[model samples]
Target: MNYITCSQGHKSTGGSNFCSTCGEPLQNSNHYLEPTLIGIQPGTRLRDRYIVREMLGQGGFGRTYIAEDTGRFNEKVAIKEFIPSVQGTGALNKAVELFQREAVTLYQLQHSQIPRFWEAFQENSRLFLVEDFIEGRTYESLLNERLRQGRCFSEPEITKLFQDLLPVLSYLHNQGVIHRDISPDNIILSGKTGLPILIDMGAVKQVTVNVATNLQTTSAPRGTSIGKVGYAPDEQIRLGIVAPNSDLYALAVTAIVLMTGKQPEQLLDQYTLTWKWDREINLSLLMTQVLNRMLAPRGDQRFQSADEILSFLGLRQTNPAYSTPNYSGNSTPIYQNPAYSTPNYSGNSAPIYQNPVYPTPNYSGNSAPSPVNNSGCGQIFDASIPVPQEIKGWNWGAFLFGAFWSVGNKVWIGLLCFIPYVGLIMAIILGIKGNEWAWKSRRWASIEAFKANQKTWAVVSLCLTGFVFVIVFLASLGGS
Candidate 1:
């Protein structure tokens, strides 16, 4: 029968041996199965070792399987089946190349976080790669579990998580390897190791030609633009350049999601309005500030290296405790509620006064004698009163009238300028200086004419509007 049911329990039928829909083997029976090896079947064992068990997951490019080794080996492995495209010859060839290249890249990797690659071979035109099977959950699963508990991850949990990932990225960057895809799902939590193991180096590329033997370097950078959309940085989404800082940007977004238990999309919208650290997070202020900077829209504004982030976290370098001075009347920390109050300058003592010295007056002259010490109810000149200065400019009444006059003149100038053809050019020139000449001069002249009447200000907005209309009219007529 040229038909088979996928591990997803979906039925597929076609001429090609691979499942027409999911690209799995079409042979569904046993005993008389098409091919066989060591109690297993053919079209199943790629390198005569890995035994294809069942499907774990599938994406647009490839399908992952939970397979086991049967050839003198008893270990579970993940077989990533890269099915050649039956549609286009060019695409089939390119997919095959990418599959082989990815295997080679994985083979060259030497990090504990990265899965170890065993072998790469073909089974009836279908490429399969065997890699270490990470047993546990993905970061996405962990996030969901945290959410289900009605609790969000704490800052320390997030910091420890990223701190562990930073070394992996730092190592890759030093080797000129850009992961190109750093999302929560790609990060697998290893139950045995109790740490995140970065998986699926299929999209990984060597921007530098260090270990890659058959590397293809183009004027274009040698990494995939295929990253988780929301977590992907703006540059990576818009332009396909994969720099080390790009990873930092994604990691920052991941950290935010982990801390807030919010999807990247929700956080991104809030971030567009204004990005700031979660007040609930208890990490160092500098570290939070650094994460905020990492998510900056402009890549140039972001930090250059993971080491910078590490240093800000007080891991790679020493960061001095910077205490800001208290600006509020309270001297307590700004983070505190109902900030502390400043101490009063005076204690409980009332202010004391000195005895006054009065000027003696000539009683014999027409001038009255200065009052004697008035302790006994004699009339007293108000000692606490302040004397007003004499107005040097025009009186307040005169100043007000002059302002009214100047405003009237401004209106007249506007009416005159609104005459039509000549008005446009005249308005253009005077519009440039309308406030500078007419309205401003009135205010200046008013201030000059009446210091006491300085409080009286001519509302120049009406004058300015009138002046603009006049100038426009003049320009229109002049053009005609």
Candidate 2:
């Protein structure tokens, strides 16, 4: 039997005109006739390293090929070719430039849940990117299989799925790169690790660049938006403005699709431009609320970050000290630890640092710190709580202001404010040693100068607390 490869690189034994797997035309006669539209043929060697096996898929922008890396123990790799359907040499040059620039960023990305980028090169007038070949089916295939079984994903399964995948999105956002297209089709479930791997970074279309350039020259609209319809938000589809929250919106839509076993278009109300999910889906109230927050039509109303969603799910603790590292260009990649230690508050003791000057007064190294109430006022006048008396220890101002406090006082611990509960912990520490931290972190000309600043911060904190109480009381009275 003669074997033929489909456009999706699936091998079929029967000699049919159309591929049995992907339903793509298998005959060379039916392929695009343009000389420029040809894909690298199977068995063709490029750069004396990669041997092309078959065309995986093609879109308006590029073609993906399954290839074998001869230099790397015959490891299979996915090679993407930049072949935009544009006629002019100028258009082709612009596309190649964009591809090259984006390739540099892609190559630097190193994550377990993402395909590792190997190399990028130009050969035979075509730009190509090589990355690790993920041996798994896309989420799209999994959804279809589940639907065939007459079942949709359960709430717990969807929650677990998002928990596993949200970190990948968080990692990407930390690198300042947004996965503009985050549909089920772009996510592949790793057969080896059983993890969802993000693919198709190329879906971030160059429409923004093209439009900006065109406006500078002729004020003409140029290039089409690059994203899957229904998955992408109105901001991205209409204005081409994408942010980390935009990916969250897509993730929420993916979850809804998996839960309902319906296409995004099917679940969405065309007129209202909102999801029309049936109310009887037996989902937990917490999960439902999280999904609603994530799917809020306005970007601002949506959960601002993946960390916030994780916190809402009770999977992660608030870390006030964690700062996501920038990974753009030549910057070193910062690895973030998802797990965090909860604050220890069980006995009358203070936290001792490595520095002897910052040692707690009665900490025996065995006794645990006394538990303090979360109520703002309880933390202030609780005499049973051991407060650090060091003049220059932890700053309450830094805790309340968080990153701003760190910047103001030149204390690095302020970065932890980015973590949810870390700020509260820092604030508690500051309540004990705010004056000390403020004094040490600043360059005051005199002790009096430091004392005055601390006094001011104390007054400010008190005023803010009272103001909050007044607002709450007024709102309660209005409700009554």
Worst 10 residues of 2 by lDDT: 334-343
Candidate 1 stretches with Cα past 4 Å from truth are 1-43, 84-86, 202-223, 270-283, 316-480
Using all chains and alpha carbons, the TM-scores for the candidates as numbered come to 0.54, 0.58
Candidate 1 per-residue lDDT, tens place, 1-480, comes to 433333333344534455566677654332222221112233365455566777788765457888878763768888776543232334334445555655554566677777888887654335577788899899888888989998876777777876777767766554435576787788888899887888865242221121132333232223234567777786666545555677888888887877777777665545234343343344444555567667766655566667767876766422122111123332211110000111122433211111112111111323332211111111113333211232222222222233343344342343434456755554454443333233222211122333322333333444555788999999999999
Mark the regions of model 2 whose C-alpha exceeds 4 Å error after superposition: 1-35, 202-224, 317-480
For candidate 1, the lDDT comes to 0.52
Least accurate 10 contiguous residues by lDDT in model 1: 332-341
Clashes of each: 10, 13
Q: Give the Cα-based TM-score of candidate 2 against the true structure.
A: 0.58
Q: Return the lDDT, model 1, position 239.
A: 48
Model 2 lDDT at residue 63: 85
What lDDT is reached at residue 130 by model 1?
79
